[model samples]
Target: MAHHTLRLRVRRITPEAEGILSYELVASDGGRLPPFEAGSHLDVHVPGGFLRQYSLCNDPEDTRHRYVIAVQRDDHGRGGSRAMHELVREGDVLTTSYPRCDFPLLYARSYVLVAGGIGITPLLSMAYVLRRQRVPWHLHYCTRSPERTAFRSRLVSSFAGRVTFHHDQGDPSQGLDVKALLATRTGGTRLYCCGPAGLMRSVREAAILHQWPREKVHFEAFSAEATGAITDRADTEFQVVVRSTGATFPVPPGRTVLNVLRANGMRVPSDCEAGSCGTCLTRVLEGEPDHRDSFLPEPQRTTCRNMLVCVSRARSRKLVLDL
Candidate 1:
């Protein structure tokens, strides 16, 4: 899954509620693009010029238009959201990669969709796909307020009674009615959730407490993997040995190992640069990885032996990475 650079050409900004912005993009050739499934996401080049991922909320089948990504003005970070809000506009192109999604929904009999705030990006496509296929499902969308939600009217009118909207008036105490929702279980249903860390943690715990099958409980983290502190690495160029091609390259400074590989014409599949999604997980043959990602747990990461090369930097100077 190599990332393809695409340019955003047009945007429709709605500042009324939650600030919805629709982006129109085309491939490098400015032609019809390849097909993508529901829940597919692309690694978009952020405005300030770092790679961040965003899910495609538009209909996957519609190729005439590229995407409709909603960005809320996040007060955090060095201003990616603020730049997206202020700078990105019609005909002013920005670099975005082709679709690469980690959370592909395996076929299930029924689905219970849950979306929180900007977490609605992935689930909205799934909900639409389920309805188009006439699958048995329902969606629960929870946001801080109606003003903070992106597609409020569209969800209500189009989804009708199949969706439930819960607007919390900025109160942390007024949580979702999770106990009532999960009180009864659908025997053949798979629950899909993408939201804040708290929502995901709570949902997973309750689902496990209710004895939901480990396989049936599916989720995708909206945020990236947070590695605490990187080790004091030497100023030597690390060698990343490509497993498939049997080639080696010197790791560059001031750029991620992934960036070095991409610059060398290698199309490595990567979406979230934060290492949470396991998109860039590669086998580490010989060196000890200073593991710092959230996805790989102690019991499992002990076997990685496979390491995520995105944010997890090299421990040793001449360390090897399986591309």
Candidate 2:
């Protein structure tokens, strides 16, 4: 789906935790903002020419004139979060895409929510919606310490017994036992997790060892990780054929399809170039695609009908795209 870009004025900025800042954005015209679901996120165009995605933590039931998002300042990141923390200010106008729910919550008998650090943002919204519907759900929030936890007071007041806190105090051995949690699965409990790479890896491994239904377990990765394709010495050169204009472009080993298309004057919308976001998805009419993106499910990837051009490549020498 396409996103609508709108200029929003920063209404307020407050510290959510040690390194996290919460920003409240409202329309410049003081109009009602677009409605978003519980797990929806916004692609924010920071002061720099880069875009970053942040989850909406506000209650979906309130169709107010504002949307709230939390950003954890990462100095070593792609500079989006740092720019937002350092340069953005209250009343400053910022452009953001309409809400996109990449990590949507489907119908489940119950949910076991697991979050690490700022990963709590999306799950917090899910908790609000589930509470409203009176659905059985529990949140297991893991952080380094209580001081590093965002929305601690709000969660404590709202969720009470349903929320459990796991603090490591900088010790991994003292952290929450993810393996134990996955091993003792309750009936009809759908799993949802978002966190650092290590935590996500542990969750995935546990789910695999315990034989959890793959379809019932969901997760989202924001940052790109090192894959074999990145450092592969056998990276092949390929050609892309645009079905619309019938123009062919050569894609080199180090270049991506999206970059090649953009260089050729094809303007395509993209938010996160890391392949986690499905914003730059394009249809593949021909050829087998070496799908590298984690956004598409296994069944969809096998079909090679749609691909994320940002990171995915073609296994065949020549491929046709529905551009």
Candidate 3:
């Protein structure tokens, strides 16, 4: 889909916790905002020419008023959150993409929702939808302490018994036991987790060791870590052939297939360049893909039918894409 660029006025900005700020966005003309699903996110273009994605935290049923999002300042990040915290203010007009959801709540008998830090934004919306549908669900939110937790009071008061808090308090040893939690119920339950790399790795490892069905496990990683073959691959040049135009482009070392295409005037949709979001997914008409993205499942990656061009590279000498 083409990126939908719209001007939204920042209606309100409030500090929800330490280093965290919540912003309410609405139409500049006071018209109704676009409708979005429970787990949808908006790609907001802040200063520094960067587009950052933030989850929609408000109730999905109420779409007439405003869209809410929380930003946690990551001093070590790519200046996305820092810009929102330091530069953005109320009444400022911001350009943003329409709402899109890659991590959606699926049908299940029961659900186990896990979140860490700002990752709770999307899951919080899922909780509201689940509650209205009367579906069985549980939420486990982990943070450093009470002072660092966002929306703590509302979560505790609204969900109450369904929510669980795990605070590390600067101690790694005191963190939640992921293995024990996964070991309790392995059947008839779907697990959804979004958080820091460490927390996500723990959950993934536990699920793998417990032989959990692949379909039952779901995750959405907002950041890309440099520990995988994506960074270790020998930088080599490849070629991309656009099927419609019969044109070929050279993908030089140190660049992605998507970058090569866009630099050559081909417009491709992309959200999180980390490959976590499937926005840049393109059909692989021919050629093997060196699948480094975490979005596609192992089975689909094995088929070589499609690839997320933002981060994934070609394994063969040339790749034919349905551009």
Candidate 4:
């Protein structure tokens, strides 16, 4: 299905941290925006026509008039963050996709929230909901240093005694010991983590080593590449056959199925081509998919019934897609 788009006016832009900026966006028509959950994110259409996903950090209950998002400028990475920082300004109009959530807050007796660096955006919203619900929860926010920690003051002021800040000063060894923190599994306690690939991996590995219930652990990555979804293995040439049209296309190595379909004049909608977004998910009629996407849950990946064409490829010589 095609995702809904919104034309929003940039209401305000405030500095959140050393290199982080928060944007307050409101509907251009002065209407109430659609409500979203705590971990929802918006696919922002930034300058240069690049669609980047930014987590909504504002309280979900306060979305009656506006949506809030934070952008961390990454000079070493892609140009999306750079464009958002350099070209976007207050009062500017921008296009964005409706809010979507893959990292939703699940029901549990108690919750442990771990966030690393800019990964705090969605977890911050989760904190708001958990507080409102009066649920037992704690946030362990880790950053390189206090100066680079976004929303530190807000977190401390609003969630005193419930939030802990960890500064590693550019060393992983000094950061939170994920293994020790999750050494014991508490009954009815769920763990949610969003952060750098290393942190999330550590959390996942620790949870597995400690024999925590897989269903009780959740993760949301900033990019598939960081999670090893896009580069874990080399790609091989394959064929994609459209079930409806009976037309086939060759998918060469290093090329994505979405791009191949689009180049062939097929209109496949996509947002984050990194496979972190589910915008380009397509049903598979036949053949197994080498699922490289971080968006699909375990069930979906195991079933191999649907695949995100953005980053996933076919395991068989040819894949018959519902298209």
Judged by lDDT, which candidate is best?
4
Number of colliding residue pairs in each model: 0, 0, 0, 0
Candidate 4's C-alpha runs over 4 A off are 224-323
Q: Evaluate all candidate structures by whole-model CA lDDT and list the values in order.
A: 0.68, 0.80, 0.80, 0.83
TM-score against truth, every candidate: 0.72, 0.73, 0.74, 0.75
Q: Rank the candidates by TM-score, best first.
A: 4, 3, 2, 1
Candidate 2 lDDT over residue span 124-239, tens digit each = 99999999878788999999999999999999999998899999998867988988988877678888888774576677778889988877888865433221122122346799
What lDDT tens digits, residue by residue, belong to model 4 across residues 205-323? Answer: 78889998877888776743333343223345799998889999999654578878997999998654546557788999899898877678777787759998977777789999998
The TM-score between candidate 4 and the true structure equals 0.75
The whole-model C-alpha lDDT of candidate 3 against the native structure comes to 0.80
Which candidate's TM-score is highest?
4
Say which prediction, candidate 1 or candidate 3, comes out ahead on TM-score.
3
For TM-score, candidate 1 versus 4, the one ahead is 4
Off by over 4 Å in 1: 1-3, 27-30, 225-323
lDDT tens digits, residue span 167-264, model 3: 99978569788898898774588898887656777787788788778678887665322213232234457889999999999886445788778879
Worst 10 residues of 3 by lDDT: 223-232
lDDT: the better of candidates 1 and 2: 2
